[model samples]
Structures are given as structure tokens and as C-alpha cells.
Target: MITAIVLIQTVADRLTEAAQEVADIDGVAEVYSCAGDVDLIAILRVTNHEDIADIVPGRINKVAGVLDTDTHIAFRSYSSQDTEATFSLGLE
Candidate 1:
């Protein structure tokens, strides 16, 4: 599975609506309104990397309130690292 995070920038007053609309897209797994430079952050899990090229620019950027998007892919998960360390230590 390929996982990516889309940092979305929206029109000044449309963060909520834009987040909801992006969340409704097929490959989106989660969406949150973040308190940072970026307006909303969306988590997407797709079957392949090519799906990102097709879905993100094609559908997400086309949403009305969306101003711009920056996507980041996971190379290594911190949560997975933590889990592995804990399990390898043989702790309950």
C-alpha cells in the first residue's frame, strides 16, 4: 500500500467545507483541520503510486476551495519503528 499526506491550502473561509469534500474522495482515509501554515491535512492510502498522480492533481486540486496542495509520502513510519522496538525487547 502507498500512503501519502496531502497538505491542503484553502480559500480563507472554506477550510471546513474543503476538508469535508476531500475526505469524501475515494482514496482518502482521514482528514483534519490543522493549526499551522497549511490549512487542512489529508491522509490518503492508495493501491499504487500512480494512483496519486491521477487522483490528487485530477480530483483534489479541482475542488473549489482548494488553493494548493503539497503531498508527502511515507518512507518509514515512526509508529512502526516504535512497535518494532517494543516487540523486539520482548516486553508485554
Candidate 2:
């Protein structure tokens, strides 16, 4: 599995809508509106590396309010619990 955090910059007054659209995209696990340099944060998971290429520019970056995005792909995922539990519940 591949996981990534997509830092999204959106047009003014579009965070809520952009977050919703991001969550609706395939391979996106979660989307949150944030108060920071980036307007939104999104969690994405895919079966392969190629999926990121296909999903990001083709789907996410194409969303109406999305201005730009920076993606941080996770190289390692460490957890005490099962993988599913860790990912699903976001535990340490």
C-alpha cells in the first residue's frame, strides 16, 4: 500500500467545497479543512505508486477550487496495532 498527505491550496472561500470534492475522489481516505499555509489536508491511499500519478493530477488537481497541491508520500508506517486498526483509527 502507498499512503500520502496531499497539501492543498485552494481559492478563497472554497476550502469547504474543495475538501468535499477531494474526499469524493477515488483513493482519498480523508479530507480536512485547515488553517495554515495550506487551506486543506487530504489523506490518500492507493494500491500502487502508479495510482498516485493517475489520481492526483487527473482527479484531485482537476477539482474546480483547487489551486495547487504538494504531496508527501509516506515511505514508512509504524504502529503497535494491526495495520487496519492503525490506518482506520489513526492511533500511535
Model 1: lDDT equals 0.89
TM-score of 1: 0.84
What's each prediction's TM-score? Answer: 0.84, 0.82
Error of 2 at 67 (Å): 0.5
Shift in Å, residue 26, candidate 2 = 1.0
Best by TM-score: 1
TM-score for predicted model 2 compared with the true structure: 0.82
- Best candidate (score: lDDT): 1
What tens-digit string does per-residue lDDT give for candidate 2 at 1-92?
88999999999877788888889999999998878799998889999989999888999999999999999999987756657675785556
Off by over 4 Å in 2: 79-92
